[model samples]
Target: MPQVQRVPMRAVKNVVLIAHDSRKQDLLDWVKYNRPVLREHRLFATGTTGALVQAQTDLPVTRFKSGPLGGDQQVGAKIAEGELDVLVFFWDPLEPQPHDPDVKALLRIAVLYNIPTACNRATADFLVASSLFHGEYERIVEDHAAKRQAWLAGQGRR
Candidate 1:
């Protein structure tokens, strides 16, 4: 039932980047301004967004396929598997997305996993400014042994 593995000092913070056509610029601006903070983490982005980020910022980016081509789900899978640390998805509210299901799934999974997520410029700013960005993160793994020992002791004669 536990979500993430309590990794207190990690070398890389797996961050996923996504942006609708209209919001691509927003993503770029944020990355441009916060490249220092972002550079310390490993970045993953979808298609053109990745190319753009790489071209504009100093951050290293691992690019997945385009969102419409399943990249969104790829990132979501990472979140579900606890491989992702944060998700900064700049979505265009006014325009309709072709990959609606993928977008919905990504949002749903992020919420389900209790991962830090930002859907717009303002939220992204807040997320980037959080002390957690520079501070250590504690990964909480399932304490299986502790639970089992406690159970055994509870049922013992002593």
Candidate 2:
């Protein structure tokens, strides 16, 4: 059986926001509409989007490098480190990104770590409106370290 833990998700979540060049306006507009909810949480974002969001919304956002320049990896590192609770990424599906592999890695890490992610405004809305949004919820996280230890033991390679 896989080990599991019931962690408390605070009423104020740690959220990362990112958007492609084409969807920056869309994300900004959505952020404006959801300011009340957003203000309650810790926010982070990539370079241009972060600056734009902070400028328009007046919400303090921790800024990272631009996505093409390593912002996606930065966010993925946060997820891997268990620092971010949710990811609200407004990626442009029609446009191919220069850092496409990085984008895929970010999404993959989010899922692997069981982080709540919103790829669109609709999903973001539902996420914020859900009963669990402001309350504690249980999520399953794989105990990879332990699993690796067990595998090493079984292989007699400890």
Best by TM-score: 2
For candidate 2, write residues 1-158 as lDDT tens digits: 87655556677788999999999999999999999988989999999999999999999999999999999999999888878899999999999999999999999999989989999999999998888887777667888788888899999998
Q: In candidate 1, residue 92 scores what lDDT?
A: 81
Q: Write down the RMSD of all candidates, one decimal each.
A: 5.8, 1.7
Off by over 4 Å in 1: 1-11, 139-158
lDDT of 2: 0.91
Candidate 1 lDDT, tens digit per residue, 63-133?
99999998999898887777888899999878888889789998998876677889998898898787776
* Candidate 2, position 86, lDDT: 93
> lDDT scores for all predictions?
0.83, 0.91
| Count of backbone collisions within predicted model 1 | 4
**Per-residue lDDT of 30 in model 2:** 94
